[model samples]
Target: MATSSSQTLALQRNSSEQNRFMEKLMSKIFSFYDEQSLIDVTFKVSNPTALVPAHRLILAAASPYFENLFNGNQGTDPIIEINDIDSDIFERLITFCYTGQALITVDNVAAMLNAAIVLQMDDAKNRIVEYLMTRIDEYTLQSAYTLEHETKCEVLKQKIIEYETQNFIKISQSDEFLNFGAEKLQRILVSDNLNISREEDAFDAIQRWYNYDVPTRQQQLPLLIDCLRLTQFKVDFLMTHIQPLPGCELLAFKAVSWIREPTVRPMTNMRFTEPRGVSATNCGEKTILAVCSELNPKLQQYNKTEDKWQEYASINIDYGGYRTILKNDNLLFIGGWKSCATFNIVRSWNIRNKTWQNLPGMIQARRSHCVVELDDKIYAIGGRDGLSSVERYTTSDGWKLVNSLIDGRYDAGAVTLNGKIYIMGGYKIHNDKTNFYMDEHLQIKSVECYNPDSNTWTSCADMKLFHSSPGVAAHKGHIYVLGRGDEYSHVCVERYDPQQNTWSQICSLDVDPGYIACVLLDNKLWAIGGQSESAGKSCVSVFDEENFCWVERCLLPERKVCNCFVVPETLLFSM
Candidate 1:
């Protein structure tokens, strides 16, 4: 009996507390002038002002899609209906102009987009339509990439393509974007997922998708190039030939970025560059040297002479990580450990001096990251200080944050092609655990290609496999991926043809070097000092350029992580 009375008393107290809270709220709302008391509460009368046009008012007050239905009714028996979209959602959207707080969710985004389209708000329609395409498929998104990529309306498609491309967007049909030839969506997810740089190859993926079939056979580079120059522009037709490569998007991209842009100039210079169009095929090859860590800061080169790592001088750096190869002659290895994420220590190993020299600090420290030299400025992609945020490291501006990538990636791959950086898969933070090696990671296959020129990122082809901390090198427009990954410490090497966007398995290594750092020298790939393929032995291996083969060589006396760089006058040095 005492417990029952106590419960009843508690309920009465809670009711009193609720009434007090409501009274306070009501006091604030009713204190303004013209506010008055109703039966027992306060109320405010709303006044109307100007009258709206009858037709405009009717349209505004009526069901949004009634006009479309009315027009359809003119033809025959019309169907009339209303959707069960909640009143809360409708009110939220309707009040958006005044409150600017419509919470658009994936479930209702399509409905809202459809509403915007019905309202004939072209800007709103285009924005919502593009957003909607992301939720759908490539065929649907394809129309958005280049309206012409799908339509018989060539002129219109061309205009849209030109518009999007200028906006630095690689437009495509809705379905195509969703159904990428590469692992684009997956690549942009999380760490421990994948780390593919356009500089690496993904040939093994090509074989899996196409096989030895005629279409799969064409996915190979040598075949795709032939198709690009000779065949038609049908995605299905291109897939039908799925050579050893992946698809023809890269070819189309090259044509658009290099061939089309250079020759088809705007109004003024158009006629002048006309002659350069047909000869775009002969553009010379471009090679870049990738510098690994502070411990083994090494220079990667692709001269195609097949004489790489044949006793070249090794250059040493004073620091680790944050590597930038300048002017094709010197390597700038600045910031990393000793300083972690601070710009405290800085130096550039002059290939001429074979010794380290100093440069300005980049405002902060960056490690296990990327450096892209474009238009003479370096852009440092995302890494970690045990956090996930994207920042660009430059000497002038320091470490100013940029747009956060679609994913939190580290040990990722990045390469610059035609001035754009295609960042591939990498290991990312899977979860937050306090004890053990409790990090959980998701190996990704999605890719984000950043355009330094426009300071924007576009989604692109993804890697075939998921790997963490794989070495990447871009050679003559193809990518070579080395090092070990999650499945096996080091199992094999793969090649990715950007033109076709596919991967293929190369020769499997008798030994695998998980997280082994690699560099391209004279058309050959050289991997050095990595944890053994599950056995934990430390050694270096080389892949033959001419013949697809692997050769294991010198072993490190003590197991140590090392970075190598070409030293002027000395040969390559592994620190």
Candidate 2:
């Protein structure tokens, strides 16, 4: 029995070896060889007419259409004329006839698929279809549709329909959607899977589509109206916006009924999805507030559309370590640590008047502190003084004392997340060491949270390391800290989940080194000019939390470390 099993295994090994040898031989035989070829196929593809040598036996075995044509009729000269097929595509199909493989590219897949269909090459057609489906995207959606319509590929059409339905909102915003006619637009919008965040988006798209051909598309409003969920619109929106428009009579009528009766069914019978366009810089086209903390400290307003930065005014004295906040179009510069001394002075820049005004000062002098606006009131946390005292400021009422921190340390990182203020990592004088001559300070890694509802501050899990003057920002309900480190160590980028009360270390900014002067812009963390190991070049690094990488964007005209803010398309860097 053992001898018989060994003999069977040996026979299988020889068969495998013979199969590999035959594959190599076939690969060589598939190479272009015109000498003593069976037939010549003349292809009129472009300006140049070319002839490709092909084997009848290989073509007949590969494609039934080619087999039938070759076997049917033959004259004295076996020269076949092939039309309406690209020369390169025909050549690739011929190669696949012999080699059982072909190079399918994005540019050539459509032509190749057409040729495969004409020649009845099922293997080739299946391969090209797979390639086309994978490459279908926003840029090629129109081309895919054209191919599907011409070829009558039901499968391809269905793939495109699914894609268009799923990404209707994204595709509708694209220029291609704008260019398409009312018929095509209606077909796309009719899908129940159309993922629109707001009913206003559909209204806006229809308005834009109508505006594209105002004179002609007016008649097509009914076709467009049927796709819109008019009943989903609110009463105020209908009255103030849609009702004012000339073509929204149907929408306005339905919106009135929807408001009077809450249970009214929408035209599409689908729930109205709220807008999800929230981002790091939600302020659109507003004048950006630029505050530069440097010698000859300047306050500026940046107009993104014009790409212009106009200086508002300069402070009376040079200042550094000051925190600026934009509150209701008013720019406020509060507390700073300068060469001379720490400042408690507070000033305001009126955006409308472009003038400066002195606001009521804080209860305590503080600099290198963190200040954030919560519930329309500004809360100033620990600063250079390393005091536990906290203060809140309002327009109606001046600065007043609030709840103090459990641990007082200056140069801490602070941000408001999920309606609560979180303060983390700073340093205080090490009084226990008795090393006053050495100027010793201890960096604290403790983190605390302050709830505005209870007006109380409580401790949470400590950070992985001490972060002194670290850049802090809240995005998607999580707080990210980057750049600043303890005196003895450099801090890695860290993310704090409020629910878990835990910190996880991300990558370090070795390339974009320095204290992180980061601000959330365009849903990305924009790290401005900071102290860098890279020759102190004023560099900008954009951190994509989704991809978990810091991408170097551009270098500043000068190596000036400044606090930066973004408004729409413009970025304001304050040195």
lDDT: which candidate is best? Answer: 2
Candidate 2 C-alpha lDDT tens digits along 295-319 = 5666554444554456656656566
Q: What tens-digit string does per-residue lDDT give for candidate 1 at 1-575?
A: 74474554554557767578767754553342123222121111122221111122222333334334444543122222234434444333433422223456556655554455444333334444444444534334343444333322322332333343332213222223333442222122111112222201122233333333555344343332322222223334334443324455544444344333533322211101112112211123433233433455434432334433232344554555454444333455645654443453455554433555465665446576666654335666766542345556443245566665666676777766544577778767766677667657656777777654356676766666776566666676677766554456455566776444467656656664554556554456666656654353455667764444677754533343334433223222222
| Regions of model 1 farther than 4 Å from truth | 1-328, 339-345, 386-402, 431-443, 529-547, 551-575
Question: Could you say which candidate leads in TM-score?
Answer: 2
List ranges where model 2 is wrong by over 4 Å.
1-290, 298-316, 337-342, 351-353, 433-439, 486-491, 531-536, 558-562, 568-575
TM-score of 1: 0.41
Candidate 2 overall lDDT versus native: 0.67
